[model samples]
Target: MKKINLIIATTLFSITFSIGAFAQTETKIGALIGYGTEIENIGIGANAEFPIMEKLTISPSFIYYLPKDESGIKINWFEVNANANYYFLDEENIDVYGIAGLNYSSIKVKYENSFGLGGDFSSSDGRIGLNLGAGANFNIGSSITPFAELKYVIIDGGQLVVAAGVKFNL
Candidate 1:
């Protein structure tokens, strides 16, 4: 495991930076559709960005996964995230950034037996974890920017989330 991590670190350090997009620090509001790899379910989310300094921003978002039920069991999941975005490139119409933040994930499960011979159960658990990811924004126009992100939530069981959406400048 340590060797793999070192290899990854070395690879990242060896890559040369490329010029990409025009840098902007405007505030934006947006909505997203995301997929959780571990849950195998689709989710909807909303997020807003506030620039705190040049080339850096704080983005807060929330996502709610559509419930999934099988074999008399139902599961629901959601997450709230706060991340800092640091833009690393500035050349063309696309800006790439790295993100690191905190994640709060909640999962609820319920089981019910329709027959007269069994007991029903329900429980909910919430976890706090770390988030590491990368994202990009397409500066196609002035009023709106389209973006996509891939992030991994590090909790009891890590999950990768892929999301894409548009940000409305406000």
Candidate 2:
């Protein structure tokens, strides 16, 4: 009889904790601006974050860099990424998280040769890279959350990315 009573108590506690965790989950959408070495210019991006567990979130984002003119060549770059973030500090108004992800990046180049042959050329190859980062979210008032992050991308020659953005919870 005592064993059965203890089992019931444990099950109830587990169910209660699970429900409380789910109630704290949130979904947010945001826009970001990033600057990186490989990108060669500033990029604008957008992302959506979905909480999957008590302390874990998955975010997907797309970024497009402004075309840069280096010498006579025009370089265009962009990236699409899916990231998983783990929150070490989850608070009512502040959260700090670590990030890891995979990114697909592409670059295109256009230039005119000395022979007066003008044409557009692009890389037939795209790269899949690894991203590691950390970020913080400051929840203010009722709906707005401002964030800042730094990411290191391991790709061709590597890149260091810095980003800041604001998100609205929905």
Specify the highest-lDDT model's number.
1
lDDT tens per residue, model 2, 1-170 = 35434534653454345445545567787899999877668999887677887889877777889888887777877777778889999788889999999877777777756566765454434678998999999978778799988888888889888989988786
TM per candidate comes to: 0.84, 0.79
> Model 1: per-residue lDDT, tens digit, 1-69?
354345335433322110011124467778999999988999998887777778888787889899999
> Model 2 — TM-score against the truth?
0.79
Pairs of residues at least 3 apart in sequence or in different chains that clash in candidate 1:
20-91, 20-92, 21-91, 21-92
At residue 104, candidate 1 shows an lDDT of 79
Error of 1 at 14 (Å): 38
Worst 10 residues of 1 by lDDT: 14-23
Error of 2 at 25 (Å): 4.5
Per-candidate alpha-carbon RMSD to the true structure: 11.1, 13.5
